[model samples]
Target chain A: MAVTMHDVAQRAGVSIKTVSNVVNGYPYIRAETRERVEQAIAHLGYRVNVSARNLRTQRTGMFTLAVPELSLPYFAELADSVIQAADENGWTVLIEQTGASREREAEVLSGRRRHLTDGLIFSPLALGPDDLPLFDVDFPLVVLGERVFGAPADHVTMNNVAAARAATAHLVALGRRRIAVVGAHEGEQVGSAALRTAGYRQALEEAGIPFDPALVGEAGLWHRSTGAETMGRLLDSGVEIDAVFALNDAMALGALHALHARRIDVPGEVALIGFDDIDDVRYSVPTLSSVDPGREQIARTAVELLVERITARGEPAPFRRVVPDSRIVGRESTGDVPAGAEGRVVGIQPGGVEPVEVVGR
Target chain B: MAVTMHDVAQRAGVSIKTVSNVVNGYPYIRAETRERVEQAIAHLGYRVNVSARNLRTQRTGMFTLAVPELSLPYFAELADSVIQAADENGWTVLIEQTGASREREAEVLSGRRRHLTDGLIFSPLALGPDDLPLFDVDFPLVVLGERVFGAPADHVTMNNVAAARAATAHLVALGRRRIAVVGAHEGEQVGSAALRTAGYRQALEEAGIPFDPALVGEAGLWHRSTGAETMGRLLDSGVEIDAVFALNDAMALGALHALHARRIDVPGEVALIGFDDIDDVRYSVPTLSSVDPGREQIARTAVELLVERITARGEPAPFRRVVPDSRIVGRESTGDVPAGAEGRVVGIQPGGVEPVEVVGR
Candidate 1:
């Protein structure tokens, strides 16, 4: 049913190595011999088995990106950037959706790691410190974005704490004090929610303001519906708020929806900001101010790190964490009344939070 | 270095065939023999060569999805749905980005076809009539969306003409006389843009309205920027339009941006509508009205078709075209003043529009 390399070699009346050289685009092969092998391959309908070649070369020339879901625009955009970076390095990307399931995330390491790809660039939303023992498997891997901290691989993520502080500080700088925070996951430790919340508090304390427990809004997931739902709950809590800082852009957009439904003018009686500067924010009615977490940099750094580990397979394992710089991008959301402010960096992390250790791109 | 099957066979004190049978989950072998083979495999850290197995079985149990880019939410969601469908049938998906280039689309047919996957589910944007002949390849393929109209393979697409007509008629039914269109490709013959435009004309003709060329906005890509730029030009052209029907949701969102920038009210002085009910459309400020083109149905049909072709490789070469049913979903954009209309079917093609069908799932 399928032609093998041996069949092509037999048809060409040449050694299998000669036929392999022709198929591999080896310049050393004689023109006449190469032509004969090429003709034999064409006649026999021979397909070079990439995985079999990978077995021989010990390199698959492919990588897998395991993200939660593509329906989320942030992950989708992150995938786009990762694929672009992978393409630049001459690799095809295999997409694996986990849907943020703990079982599925663990299965990726145990089941799909072998004989599939050279390395994996994974972003987990489910598995956390409890799953670290599973990461002891002998595989070249790079982790990205939230969960599985202290994994034995290169970890590329945004400065969530620093970036959140900047976002909150920006709203405070605009003369808004009573800010509500949306999309806080319950009992989160090192996740994006917890870190961002810590930064938000730091910003409040720096401004000589006390942290109010009622200002924190709980969301089941970082979805638009949840954002709106949680914000609606916050509004119904009877807590007077003059500003809002949702963890991500989707929740912020959702918060905007809630505010509009309640007949509140954005950035007039209340200022607003979100994280993860997705492109849609640019076209939103009032536009949106957000923390640009350097997603492209995350993608490039993750892929580069994975490639490095793949090429240097036998090297001693080095635990690396690459944190990209971030800042608050001001837009119409944080503007004063009739304020269509130009996009400016409203806040930056003090001391340039690019972590002096580990490699920087 | 990865362990080989020969080592496992050696350790098991059995023939390689016996070990292979155990690894392949073939149940004919004795339970005792299977246990011995499994223990040997576990001890030796043996991994079965998937490509070598593919050579023997003539099936990789995998599929490739070649789209222009995943940055577009439509393709990303389509990929998600395709992966979901494939996973149900026990298959992994490989993603290949073509960057919407004619050369790259053709290359997939030639270069990436061999020894990669059991089948390919492609959504080509750049390839047209000139590349139709390349579709006659040995690999099993199912193409999605509006391109390569008469290729000798399975096609699963939305009825663009009918869907577009339905969208336009929705606007017309809202009592908007002068309707402008955004995202018309320049001189396209059988693409989505051309089919959609033709449908818009058909709807206008049905209403006894004249086809005004000035109302058709030209755009190179169906992106937000192009949608806004074309709508901006339409406004600057002084063509008095009471409504707009953009070809896609992204463009419609962009048109909203331009309208917001110009201080024109949506669904007030001018009504608006778009196609492809992407999730973001639901969250847009005015909540855009769009034609639900049955994206999940398209993905399911395409993957199912490719799987059918893979399983029944030597069956009669029946060229199937599965056109899923589409309906217009109404939101604030096309609603009467202060009207948030519920979803309704504005138009349905008589006889169900299955002119030439191969299989419908």
Candidate 2:
């Protein structure tokens, strides 16, 4: 049987409140009393019942993270990083999938089940700035994603616009003109699709290259299938493109498949680049080049922000944006040369090529 | 502002306890009083706070599922199914990754964080039968995995021994004798590795084939890299094998990579099979053949068991084993058909394959 606080108090000849005070690090406790309680705790092996303590404090010491889907490797990796960060801070995380639906996203922020958790870290895909009022709850929330423009909460995200520009610039640096963009959502003014498209255009304009409408492929979702289908459509439409920029790794993989089916050699006939440096990219057939969007930093920042809000005891922290930098990871997919460039490999770009367009607001 | 129970009770001219009773559907409330409370609830738009009500009942309406990792697609998909099942029962799920550490597994069952959750659905890879006593705590728990034997709590898992036999038998049926087993844990006696290895031997004996020790490859971890490395080691050891069975999908993928490197024609020169029907298998080059261990059913059953325990109000429900069936999903990798037979998909095994070996001593 586990030892109770009462047992520890009895063993130390101190009041149960004194033990509690010591355990909670109450400043009023004398050093000798604290030392005695601590010694007794170690001797009796009295581990505090976090649940019982939570009842008194009305805090569960647990947080909830709601993402669109985990089947997507990106989110799966993100969740893994978040859990690791949360564990380091002595908190447990509950995971929920909103499936990128507005209703589900709203439900998560409603706080109807707030008692089950101390706070929430939400990544909404469908909910936008128009739904900002839904976040007006009494719980601490740290939002991730570009779907919601100005939600009232702490947000940790990548510089989507700048990152997209960097990816396009990398392809341009490889001397590939007429770069095609895959995974753009039609009629959308914000979100990842719009932001990445804006960045792509920004890079092309700076390079003095014409922005060709025929080079833009519309993808409803940034999924592999969508990317493949869009790439096929772009080709079928007779777009003259020597390079491709997929919004994410999944789409990039899909593009690779499409190009393979058409016997279009990557970086030979056309260069390819993707976003989100997913783990699989390293092991891909040609090892895809992608953008590393500081995922580790985002996870740590989100957890720390949520923790600050929880510890502040109702002092609402100002909504702050954590903009992490993104770097291009050059691999064979981008025609980057093999490490031992002894002329054995043909048509390979030199390693560490500079960006064609500089990053700026 | 959200409406509170107080508003409903005051409007209904009844005490808060009466409103609580009505909301909870407690027996013995007068019919007219219930009717009045219901009307007041609807009029005031008072949605019951699930978390607060759980607090009053000393239950959290939340269960925690601890797995080794989420970066693995199998666990991520399993978590998604579990969350879906829990949501259907008006419950929430919390996720924790123990990294297959015995110490962390012990902490989960320690009951120190009981207030954060009602029960736990744990999948332990490191701990075994010797640690069962550690699970004898106040809170409820359901164990998931083939690692532990004779656990006191309810067990939910795939029939690893039987499934492995069926997988090997499939290879035997294909006229392959000298089959290699990848991803075996050397010297394991009772975990999934040991059980699967025993099944492999049983299948070999039944086929009147000698069990070649050199044919078994040991992997430190059941990952794709390890699988690939083990396959390479097996080949380097000069083991002439006609077929290979990987313990899991990741290892199988690694094995595929190894075979490709060696220029072995799959199904023509050597047939390859893997366990765990990961989503990526369908799109993989040559596509992978694998076993579907009814993970969806296991997730649903675990969630159902936890929900029952939570609603039982301290009543101890009898523990039972949920042994879901497994079947082979044949793809191009198995060499079941000629190349370009993409559309000729086979159906799931009828009556589902039963476990070949039952441990009922």
Candidate number achieving the greatest DockQ relative to the actual structure: 1
What is the CAPRI rating of model 1's predicted complex?
A: acceptable
**Candidates 1 onward: DockQ, in order:** 0.27, 0.18
Clashing pairs in 2: A51-B115
Provide chain B TM-scores across all predictions.
Answer: 0.80, 0.79
User: How good is the docking of model 2, as DockQ?
Assistant: 0.18
User: Each candidate's root-mean-square deviation in Å?
Assistant: 13.8, 14.6
Question: B1-361 in candidate 1: lDDT tens per residue?
Answer: 6675556767887655466567767667898888888898888877765755555375667788989877777887888889888888887777777879787788787623346567788889988777765665556788787777677678888878888887888888878879999998767787889999999999999988899999999988887778888988999899999999999888898888788778888888888998888877766777788888888888888888888888873334566778888878788888722332234555554312233332211
Worst lDDT run of 10 residues, candidate 2 chain B, spans B352-361
On the 0 to 100 scale, the lDDT of residue A130 in model 1 is: 80
**TM-scores of the models, in the order given:** 0.80, 0.74
Which residue runs of candidate 1 sit more than 4 Å off their true CA positions?
Answer: A1-58, A111-114, A313-319, A336-342, A350-361, B1-61, B111-114, B313-317, B336-361
